[model samples]
Target: MSNINVDEVEEQMEEDEFEEELHETIRFLLVEFRGSLYTFTKHIANMNCERVHRPLNRRPITSRGYNYIHKILKEDPTNFREIYRMYPDVFLKLNNILREKTHLQDTRYICIEEMLAVFLLVVGHNTRYCLIRKTFERSRYNTSQNFNKVLKALNSIAADMMVKPGSAVPEKIRESTRFYPYFKDCIGAIDGTHIPATVFGRDTNSYRNRHGKISQNVLAACNFDLEFIYVLSGWEGSAHDSNVLTDALSRNNGLKVTQGYFFNATSLFNFFLFFRIIYSIHYCGVRYHLQDFTGQGRHPEDAKELFNLRHTSLRNVTERLFGIFKSRFKLFKTAPPFKYTTQTEIVLACAGLHNFLRKECRSDEFPVETEIEVPPSSSEQVYKDDNFGELFDTQEQQRTNTNAWRDAIANQMWSDYDHIVNKS
Candidate 1:
């Protein structure tokens, strides 16, 4: 027994010596390459290996994890709704997608659900990473890392989720007496709005809008059902809607409206340049119809006025879409403190989430509150209407052609309205 005890003590002392040597080696390497990142990274890797082998004395990750998250989700669902901006089933679906995409290899103690929560909380509320870290009892680095991980996962799903609904104007939109046949060829509405952005260098000037806020001009297209079909974000705030629209249609991977189908956006229509598009407002003063159709938002007096009125009413859904988008994802109203590149990614990621939540919804009532108004065209200043012909276009021939087309549509709408009113 004494011999066995002595041998055990000797073996223990040797193990201690080996551990001390390992520590000394690490310390020496760190000092020798105090500025070398590669060596420092290797040192951290070795330490992490030790940690994996060592019995964990640290408390379980609770904040971004099961300890607190699971409790909140199960015990107080309303609180869960406030933080996640979504219900449990939606959260669970996104969680499953993250797990499936990441193959459950995220071993950083942050579960898939927690990662998604961090992402939504960050973008939806524009909360800082430190607050999230405290909420989840995680380090700031872990909070940010998982936020990005989940963000990328959501972006990956955007291509699949943000898609055309096979039929742009469904039976419901087509059957409405106010819109039928008049807008049968119309699939959706399109428009641009500004989101605050932070960028430095020469880019600062380009992104600065007349409102004096640095922003990114984002163009979005949504169908009548209030679902986003396409979104093109990340243009400089100074970029005209026409320029942005031109670029979007020019890109091979950009928005594609079928040959006959169209989306209503406010831009100059060039018969040669735009074979598939028609401007919602006139290339000239024809916007009066669209404006009255918006400002007072009353029924217009003439057939032409009535046509614009109905068009504006239906097209306003895109504006409402933006309102809901900004309200639900507050990060969009303010510049999120991420790199400009990541900021752009966040924009697209949030849109993807919007579509995801919309698809997952089981009820008809929209959960997000949005008090919407007509935003200025790329031409409006300080939310006030302003003519942008000097900045846009004023071609006589295009104007004539547009007026002719609208006149035909107006006559048709008038005939339909007369028949409905007279019959009644």
Candidate 2:
């Protein structure tokens, strides 16, 4: 065998081994190529499937979304303080109120807390439904239904939430040095604000105010504590405060005015006629004193000026009340795009909520939250003759009687005030 070409035998064996290795390499390469092609096909199929089966509006909150909610509304006590400032019992009592009143049942997807979160986002943030729908993973219909449902529930509770000044309020005025005898009988201050609103029709002009925007002239009365005692909204923005007051008063058991009480008034209403209409309700408003009398004009020359200054000062409660209301709800800050009727209901709802918060929270005033900074104010009102002009005495007799009563109160204020000059 050794002599039979052993070297040749070794060389042939080496060639065969090389051929086997080449075949193995080709087989490996083919397997790898087929595997890569299969992967590519699967990727393309996934893309096509995604396009065909799109996402639905009603879906669960993604993991990231759940994380965000937890971040804002913490599980522990550390961050809940911030939440309480928006309104105490926001998470606790609000859900109860809604659940008790609203017929909406909680499903596997939506819960009471989720629905309230959506409502508050609209009120506190003035967020659009579409944006909230996206965040909560709720259908647009779901968002709208819950929002209006809560709004209706809030409206239903407005009257109950209102703080009536009639209950032991005059005593507060009687004891106050800022008001004293002049406003001793005063229940509150009355004024009208232009809240921007939108409407469609021939009556649209009626909804537009002097600012040339559509709004409602909302009449509200507030007391020393800066609580709204009464609210009369839904009048055409063009409606005068005096006219609105008349309508409210003329209704059966309407805005009942106590005899001998007074309301610090402003130029927005006809003070002279208002007194005659309510007959028993006295009118005490800021008087125009042309005299820069003492030259400094800081000091009042007569009782009327003093009364006017005091009236302006005390009546400022209503202004502060409005600031609180507007600042709290974004819906009020911006022009609300609802029908005139809905606009009225929104006003009442907000006012009721305001009173409810004030009574419930018992804070000096609504803390200006940095979350809502300088919301836009809407304007809507139209100038027209007051509807109640002829309802009361146009005669000078009641006018004279009102002037005499007001003068008596002013004189009493002047006499009562301790005057002393700091002379050196």
Best by TM-score: 1
For model 2, state the Cα shift of residue 321 in Å: 0.5
Q: Model 2: per-residue lDDT, tens digit, 63-111?
A: 3333445456656544553433344345556667767765645644456
- lDDT by residue (tens digit), candidate 1, 220-326: 88887777888888899877666677677888878877765767654332222333455555323444434455555364556766766677677778777887788
Best lDDT among the predictions, by candidate number: 1
| lDDT for model 1 | 0.71
lDDT per model, in order?
A: 0.71, 0.65
TM-score of each: 0.75, 0.71
